[model samples]
Target: MLARNDQNSLRRTPLYGLHVSLGGKMVPFAGYEMPVQYPAGVLKEHLHTRTAAGLFDVSHMGQIALRPKSGRVEDAAKALERLVPQDIMALAPGRQRYAQFTNEDGGILDDLMVANFGDHLFLVVNAACKAEDEAHLRAHLSDDCTIDSLADRALIALQGPKAEFVLAKFCAEAPSMKFMDAGPHKVDGIECFVSRSGYTGEDGFEISVPAGDAERLAKALLENSDVLPIGLGARDSLRLEAGLCLYGHDIDTTTTPVEAALEWSVQKSRRTGGARAGGFPGAEKILSQFDQGASRRRVGLRAEGRAPVREGAPLFADATSGEPIGKVTSGGFGPSLNAPVAMGYVPTAQSALGTQLFAEVRGQRLALQVAAMPFVKNTYKR
Candidate 1:
């Protein structure tokens, strides 16, 4: 059984009661009471999602809609382009793209997903950074655009190899949707906005439904024989195994998208020699890094032993001595791999695919090596 808390100050998602009833271990995260694991535990949950389907309640994420005041899609896209380096204007309707909110110093404010919904742009950002993102958008965007916060909605993610099969049972068109495709759909008569994208490097869908109908929708999905409720614990491990970065941990306000190895998100149209170039914040600094390369970069690490080198662990060039070279940002045991895996920042010279390094953990040194990411291969539906 999961532990219960009497604290009433923390915010609750629409599925809070359902989680409690299902043996969810509630914990405080991003100002909300969310489940970190269920009775099955994180390890089982992680492996289960890999084999079948796992239902995730991600209602803590912030959802926003940007509508152009003039009803011209170009207006809203243009305004957003000023904040991100991605070529928003080129985004086709019903398609989604990954982007970051860059700062003047070339640092990342927050990474988010942008979906062009024909008349408006739908966005999903980190819950912790949502308020700041909204404020920044309002302060920078022109009066020709309007930003609306979708505070009355809930977001659910169904991920795994069987995710498509489970979701297709309710929405017939779901199986035909390709990766990053998003549009309106009805599941059991409840209207929802479904996206064929997720953080877990797996074939999945993220459904946005009204808060009032969230429980009913969740219950229906849970009744599936192949579906099980997953929580934050497994979610973190899954994303880490998939080589995805956590907002504040791997990529933060101090880290630029280029340094985080997210340059692919910045389209060529916003780069030099493209149709529209260099309009986003910190364009000069970011573009320079793209040309000359960054001093440090994010890299994946594989532990030589079974001991998991956790986050905040300092890294060194030598096992016994020498100054620290870098630090582990995200680290833990990868259940699927049955080994210790981590991601961190290191000097560009030491960021090769097989560079040897050592991690300091509890006064002991653990051997580590720079490795390619997605520790597990992605299986997105093309």
Candidate 2:
């Protein structure tokens, strides 16, 4: 059911052929003709990753390095903190943190991963924001920090309950790393940096290696009886279940981190009245929002029916109809939840866990209740 020739209008990953050979259903994603599912389908693919181990081709993401000429970590980190809210200066070497790039208006430009390597800051930005993010960094960052896009590298994720077990076979030392810690390692003779982290809220590793070596390394991973090649379709469901945001969908230029339920990502020291207030982009507006409290807040919703409510679905305050309050950002059938689940924005009054709302799917209003995120418990290797 997959057509390789349909890729004429889309970009191709180096492992495109390998994905097809592995029974992947190729689909257009972020300008690339990529795998959306496999022979096992999205449901099974999602479950497999939770129960066993699954590998994903995330090379389409943008990898970048920030190198300070003097190799001063504090200088580079302090400069980066000017654009992001994370305490980059406090990120210990070999550790990583999730952060967002802010616009002048205090809105999130993009959410990205930043790792503190000994000599440079390693980063993974969303694929769709690669060009704009780099441009933003170059235009605003301190002159001491140089931005180098690692366009020649490919990224893969190995995730599941048994992730560390499978990875230990090739890199025994990897098992010691806690969630969000990354370091250089050799897995089955392939040199790569593996981070004990993932978007699915499962124990996993994201491996960055030379682009040319991705296919070979992928093949090696598949050789393990416990690992299967997962596609983007399942990736979405997994992350949705994990309560992770997808750049363009869950957040964008108009969404502030505070309203997006990402206030936790903002360190207390950076909040209003703290030592660092309003130094980053839109600091005044962000701090003001916190002081005044945002009218709307992001929340998780579970439908009372089996029908799925997808992106752009209108959310109403009451099942009968009070008024249009918000809309669904990410929604789908959650294999783990055994029902339809969604995440979206709603008025602060209606964002509580037991608050009831209505989602308009196909013009039919379905009862939905505000639920806690990570519908499934996260089992990250601590």
Candidate 3:
């Protein structure tokens, strides 16, 4: 449940005033004054972003650089993999991967994006957990690696159907890049690292630019009528429909990647590797869960009624009398579906597709049926 009122104590993004002037409903998120919705509202924002483009201020996320003492890309990847689960050594140049910072108990401290930047590892971690993640990485990283937070970078996500077209106005060579491919480029004279990856399940780009030039770049993007400023409200719903997990809400330190249905992020090569093996904290339990299976699993749900089930809603075995099975992590009125939908965890026995569960919403249990993820068909351009 989101309060309409503002409660942010953090700073504002460069486009804060621009968003407000465009009728954006500002709200506090991850310690930043961000837009939750615009004059078009969540539904229109969602659909517009799907059919057109939406610019998002994800600058609140923590950006950091990991440099190797050897200053070689290959050796740096090897040293960094010791702290994560992915096979960084195999990650091709200009490629990115989703990874987690894990604790000693196989719990995920935070989920982050790792981009192989030739000679450095570019990381974008959750702002709220950035401090802790940095400290943990610093404490465990071998002397061969040096971790430094980039405080002067701003991240902006240009997402949707026309995202490539919009981004092309800046980088002429970006149109041919496939998803997860990234490289250094210039956007309106400002140097940036652009990646063709996003959370909206649409063809998009995440641009990392100097903080001083972020405002100019954002304005340049908005010059296209096809591109609108979307707030956090629509961002959340979009990611939800895409079956993308949100840290702190859908996953936490107690949740393992395997349990969270994110095993794809781990490569088999890394699982049985040389220097860059899966040697991070709690590797035993994580590996065991992979082999034997987990007790509960994350799943998507379709509500029987029009009533929107929200986060923290309790889930039960049946509509009548059954103990709590799991809980909703992300739920909302899906703009694409024009109906209420949700995603959450449930016992493995009850996680099968079409299995029925009841979500307790407003003192009444609403029948919810298990469904395949991505409530809306993804429109990524291959």
Candidate 4:
């Protein structure tokens, strides 16, 4: 999420003023001025989210609407299927699914969330790739669908064990929403799109509210003793602990869904010989990899020592190996595990559990082992 260019041109979210008042450290990210962490700092903010709740301002993300010309949501689903490999048609109303926009080579352009809102489809794409994603949709699916960017809405995420207990105070429907359940709901009299899903591996909700009401709602949520204002620093660490991918670091145009260990997201209905299979972009290259597995795969690495192996650290087969076989994409100290964990791409033979590998950090080769992900347990409501 690092922006190397310039900081002056960065855009600010609707909650920028509120973030400043809360003592958030603003940083440049994906062309926006976002909070990296509040005065409580990353370590405490990360742990607070695990034990109680954390309020995140995710308005930098792109929100778009896809409405079908035929006035049938099924038509919109069919149009979306042409771009993604997910079973969008099978997505029932008021439900959401994870999907990726693939290129001709099966490489992921960007990953996003698709929710069926009955009248239209709502999409939440990454901030950096949102422009391209919207353009991609307009270029391919505009013939039968109306593509509009929802610039008036802001996205906020309340994540943790007590998220429901806090949100249910204003929105009564929050308790009944199972995982992936999403639709328009009134939150403090503000009609917003609420999804029972989030980037964190905890039971939480992603609320899409009007830009004007974002500040008030966030302040209200923060009034609770358990909800703390978290920033990008803690957000990254939390998601990293959850073993979730960070778009450019973990996946990009050079990596495919199969290689990223996200094959589970590509539903069976869109695979092999299923009824609606092979209709999306890169269908040939992607589906073939399912049969003949990918050469490299993303795997979790648990450091043998307390020292954290940061991203871009070269990974070697052994401490004696001169060249590198892989590289760390996202690595950090896990607050929950009280140890260092990392994720990176490695050969299939070395991706198995208990495989010992070495990461070259500074001048030392640190011992690490291929380990299971979600370093912390996921408590999503089933």
All models, RMSD in angstroms: 2.5, 2.6, 3.2, 2.3
Model 2, 1-382: lDDT tens digits are: 1123463767777788899898888887887888999998888899999999999999888888898867797778888899997778888999999999998888899999999987889899998899999998899774879999888788999999888888888787788999999877888787888899989989999999887888888898889999989999999999999988999988998989988989988877678576665579888888888888888888999998899999999999767766789999999999987998899999898888989889887778999899998889999977
Highest lDDT scorer = 4
Candidate 1 Cα misplacement greater than 4 A, ranges: 1-8
In Å, residue 66's CA in model 2 sits off its true spot by: 0.4
Q: How close is candidate 2 to the true structure, as a TM-score?
A: 0.96
**Model 2 stretches astray by more than 4 angstroms:** 1-9, 272-275
Superposition TM-score, candidate 1 onto the true structure: 0.97
> Could you estimate the TM-score for every candidate?
0.97, 0.96, 0.95, 0.98
List the candidates ranked by TM-score, beginning with the highest: 4, 1, 2, 3
Better of 2 and 4 by TM-score: 4
- Per residue, candidate 3 scores C-alpha lDDT tens digits across 96-157 of 88898877788888999999988888889997898888887788775778888887788899
Give the alpha carbon lDDT tens digit for every residue of 1-382 in model 4.
2123354777888899899999999998898899999999999999999999999999999999999999999999999999999999999999999999999999999999999999999999999999999999999999989999998888999999999999999899999999999999999889999999998788899999999899999999999999999999999999999999999999999999999999999999899685799888899989999999999999999999999999999999988866788999999999888999999999888899999999998899999999998888998998
- Candidates in order have lDDT scores of 0.92, 0.87, 0.86, 0.93
For candidate 4, which ten residues in a row score worst on lDDT? 1-10
Candidate that beats the other on lDDT, 1 or 3, i.e. the better one: 1
Q: In terms of TM-score, how similar is model 3 to the real structure?
A: 0.95
